[model samples]
Structures are given as structure tokens and as C-alpha cells.
Target: MSIAEKLSQMGVTLPDAPAPAANYVPSVRSGDLLFVSGQVSSGADGLIKGRLGADMSVEDGAAAARACAISLLAQVRAACDGDIDRLDRVVKLTGFVNCTPEFGDMPAVVNGASDFLVEVLGEAGRHSRSAVGANLPFGVAVEIEGIFRLR
Candidate 1:
């Protein structure tokens, strides 16, 4: 089934793509690949701000990161004219977490986004990933970017 249909089956309703904060496209299509811009934990309402392991728990950071993942998917569907079937599989995912000096839970925080992909795409979502701690993630708690191979 198409990804949009899959989303419907899963009862997932994508939000509108958030407006870009700077001079950059949200997603870029080159050949059969789409490179999604780094999406911070921001909603249509505003940015989800805080520092994981300091101002927030790992679960909170993970939830915020997953929200960003949803936003990323929204951008993908928007770019593809509301159809998500063009996606073949996820290629890679990179997540950056705003953290404290002693925070060693970057991977846990990024699991927020990682887990979402699997939930939505099943095996197609499996991909190499990198979760790094950052001083700040565009001033948000978490930020994630993804690469996908297109059908």
C-alpha cells in the first residue's frame, strides 16, 4: 500500500510542514533521493525547547524528537503532492540532542525519532543512524535529519 494509505491505516494524521526558520528548503530532491533538512523539535505552534538530561527527561526529549520526525514526514508528503509512495526506504538518520556536559544519553533521546520511523515504515525504516550530543540544536531540544531512497 502507499505510505499515505499506510498512515491512514495507522490512524496517523500528518501536520502541515512547519515554516522554515532560515534560508533553506525543508526537503531537497536529487535524482531518486530526498534529503530532508534538519528538523528541530518544533510544532506548528512553536519550537519545543529545553536541554535533555537537564531541563528534561530522556522520555521527554524522545517525545519531542519524535514530534520532529512527524514534522519531517509531513514535509516529505508535502513535497510529493500528498503521496508518500515514492519513498523506497530510509537510507540514514542523524539526530542531534541538546545536552548537558554530563549527559551520555544521546542515543536514548534520538530513539524518539528512530522508533517512529519503524512504527510507520516497518522494515523500510531500518537504517544507519548517528545520535550526537550538541550544545544546542538550533535552540531546540532535539533535531533530526534523514535521507531516503526513492522508488
Candidate 2:
């Protein structure tokens, strides 16, 4: 099935690619690689913000991470000239979770994005990853960036 069909099967509708809040572009292509900028959790309900291990549960944080992944896909679609099918494979993902210093479930939280990608792209979604605790920008709960190989 096409990427759009897969997304539809998954009950996902890609939102408009968000404009950069800063001076940097949302995504850039170099050679066959596309580098997507970090995306924070901001869905239909607005930014998901809270410090994990303090006021947010792992499940909630994971949901925020998933939202960030959706945003990443939106950026990737835009980068591919509105054709996500042009994506060859997911190369890597760097996730940042806003949490207390004592929190140590970064990997699990990031798995939210990882799992969703694999679900949407199957084998093409498997990729190297890094999940770290951080005081993310705008005080968002989770932030994620991705690198993709373009067809």
C-alpha cells in the first residue's frame, strides 16, 4: 500500500507541516539525506508540557513523543515535495524528553515515536536512535528530530 494508505489504515491524518519558530528551516536535504528539525509536542490540544517523574506519567510522555513523531512525518512529507512515498528509509532519531534529573525512562518514552514509525513504515522505520533527558525548548514535554534517506 502507499504511504498515504498506510497512514489512513492507521487512522492518522498528517497535519500541515509546521513553520519554524526560529530562523532555521524546518528541514534540509543534503545528498540523499533529509535532516528534520526538532519538533515539540503540540497537537489539537496544544503543547504537552510537564516534567516527567514530577507531574507527568511515562504513558503521557510517550503520547507526547508520539505526537512529536507525527509532526516529524509532516516535515518529512513536506521535504519530499508532498510525496512521503519518496522516503527511502528512516535513518536515525534523536529524542529529548523533558524530565527531572532523577528520571531514567527516556528510552521507553522515546519508544512511542519509534513504535509508531515502525508501524507506519515497517522495515523502513527501523533506525538508530538516542533518547536523552533534557530541558527542552518552550518547556514542552518531548522533542524529537529525525534523519531520513530519500529515494
Number of the predicted model whose TM-score against the real structure is largest = 2
Please give, for residues 55-148, the per-residue lDDT of candidate 2 as tens digits: 9999999999999999999999999889989988999999999999999999999999999999999999999999999998888999999999
lDDT score, candidate 1: 0.85
Q: Lowest summed lDDT over 10 consecutive residues: which window, candidate 2?
A: 42-51
Task: Give the TM-scores of the predictions, in the order they appear.
Answer: 0.91, 0.98
Cα misplacement distance, residue 5 of candidate 2 (Å):
0.5
lDDT of each: 0.85, 0.94
Off by over 4 Å in 2: none
lDDT, candidate 2, equals 0.94
